[model samples]
Target chain A: MSNIQAYLRPDSLEGALALLAEHQERARPLAGGTSLIFSHPPRVEVLVDLAGAGLDHVEHAETGGVDIGSMTSCSHLATALRGRQLDKSALTDALATLYTPVLRNHITVGGNCVMVYGWSHLPVTMWALDARFMVVSHKAKPRDVDADTFFERHPLRWLGAGELLTQITVKSPAEGSGSAFLKFGRDKSDEGIASVAVSLRLQDEKVASARLVVGSTRPMPQKLDDVAALVVGKRPSKEVFAEAGEAAAKAVVASDNYLGSADYRRHIVASLVRDALAKATQRAGGAA
Target chain B: MKIRLQINGNTRELETTPTRTLLDVLRDAGYYGVKRGCEEGTCGSCVVLMDGEPHMACLIFAPAAVGKAITTIEDPDGDRPHAILRALADAGAVQCGYCIPGMALSAKALLDATPDPNEEEIRGAMEGHLCRCTGYVKQVEAIKRAAELMREEASHE
Candidate 1:
């Protein structure tokens, strides 16, 4: 018999959380089920469907940020973001590159964040934006976890027993900020082999603060602090961008896999980072 | 668990295990058009219109599809072929015919959402399906032809 023994579609969040609390590790929340249905763990006996939990939404905060509900489909988010006249296209562009259109119709934003697959691009972009994750569970008050810290370990193993990610809150970038996302894959339709996202906030035409994230080159998306250190306080120029990319290339310990060799990934990462930085710098100047 | 679904405009009740995928349920229900290629979501052979949107049936748990409208390629116009199917037939887009249903449904969903899609939009909508024979050139032309047919139908209404 299949290990998936029971499916629970709770009409209310409380009902779902209580069920999750009761079942604990035996229960797994079914978000798009793109990842879960493929690899049903032996221990997962109850699949909690959150479709009716009403977690799907994307609301622009009065404070000028966006709150993305966990169940919001990736396609919907991409359409919403594409319609917005944002100063940066990093998040929207990154989303457009994820999976095929049919898959996007099913993959949820929260599922992507929680699953944290190696080729997942949204989390890397979220990390670059310093997005905060809202998680809920029994016996714990809903709390916001920093996106940076949320993936310290593999996210699938990082969630507390029975806990579910509810929403992701991304603060609005400061004025004159620009972000860029770039992914390198075998083909335009293929998953990312290496991806880089860069966000830069410029003040007085100098990079005041910068966030750089590289994905697919490592086990998890990582922040390029060394690259940031090189770019900060420096004027936005091709020279500085290339220097930062070179530094990132040297710093990232890329893996050798079927998609690419470690050496090839390192080289691609440098060029992608350079291109992303250059595009971000140009956008920053325009925004400024 | 037993779940009720509106499949291809008919309300059907299915008794299936919670682990059963919608793909398996639909195929077992005799919707052979819902092909079972790549149990993974990568290939679009199992693509279906769930609540007016294209989704991979292979990835969707059967129970999760309850209370939603599921439209398969077989019943797009309730026995009458959809304009997308007609367009494919006219354009000679089907080769081997395995990927046609998915490609047609994707085009139908795109046209339903955006009636006037450009070449880029057609390619984007059809990006998920893998057709080994056509090189996608004829598929793109078929989608464009489908959109024109749809527009003509709407104008006459």
Candidate 2:
């Protein structure tokens, strides 16, 4: 029999948080149910459905950037991003490479953010964009956690008993900024063995700022600071991107998994990072 | 718990546990068209239209589906087979046919929104369905053909 015994659908966020607080460790936040339902954790006695909590939305923020509700599905996020006519396509491209359309239709951005599954693509994009997560609980005031710090905290284990990620804020890229995401999956259906996301801003045909994030080859997506530093102030060129690729291959930390071996992952990461950088540079040229 | 949901345009009430997936409940309710494959939700065999959007039933909790409009393969208009199904049959896109219902539903969802999608769009739309047989070339052709048929039908109207 399924171990879950209780289901609660609160119409308000406060009510949901209150329920989460009361249930404590026994309550699990349910978003899309794609990830949580499969594990069927023995400790999860109650599911607090966030479907009715008005968390599925994408809107522009007054302070610039975009505020996306945690419950917004990847499909919805892609559509929203396309509609906004933004310069950054890393997140959208990341979502596009994610699971199949049916799964993407149900996989919520919030759940992906919190779950941070090794194969998930959005966290890598978030790392490139320097996104922030807005989390709230029963008693604590709403707080924003930087994407890098959030990933460092080990997302799956970080949330307290009652805390829920309510929103994600992705700041708009600077003018002449371009970003791209690429993944090399073992198969068409499986998650990527190596994935790369690159965001670069150009000034006078030189890299003003750069962020390169590599994921799926490691437990958490890691920003290749060494690689990013090499690209900054460098002119965009095939040679520069190739050097960055080599740097990424050397700097990335990987482990063997069902998808690929560490060596194979290293090779894939290098190639993808090169392609991602080239694409980002080309887009940056256009933006410039 | 007792819940009422709209499936295939019919409102039905059923008794279900909190943990039952929509896939289990739908199959038990005699919707055999909703295939039971990859209960992990990786495979697209259990996909259904939840509020007119394609979603894997295996991943959705039964209680969460209450009050939502659920559409199964059986819900498609029987008298007039959807252009997708017709195209698939015309192109001989079925082999074992285990994945057809889900594929058709995914195609239908796509065609409903984008009547004339390009090859890339078609492939992206049906990426969720895994047909071990036919290799998806025929399926891709069938969806492209379906788009033409849909456009023809719209023009004639």
Task: Report, in order, each candidate's fnat.
Answer: 0.95, 0.89
- The candidate maximizing lDDT is 2
* Model 2 lDDT tens row, A157-230: 88889999999999876778888999888665468899999988999889999999999997688898889888
Give the range where candidate 1 chain A is weakest over 10 consecutive residues by summed lDDT.
Answer: A80-89
- Candidate 1 CAPRI category: high
Q: Among the candidates, what TM-score does chain A have in each?
A: 0.96, 0.95
Per DockQ, the best of the predicted structures is 1
What DockQ does candidate 2 score? 0.77
User: Distance from true position, residue A1, model 2, in Å?
Assistant: 6.6
> How well is each residue in A6-124 modelled by candidate 1, as lDDT tens digits?
89999988888999999998998989998888784878889999998999899886656788999999888877665454524688878888978888888899999888887788888
Which residues of candidate 2, in runs, are more than 4 Å off? A61-64, A187-189, A286-288, B155-157
Give the clash count for each candidate. 0, 0
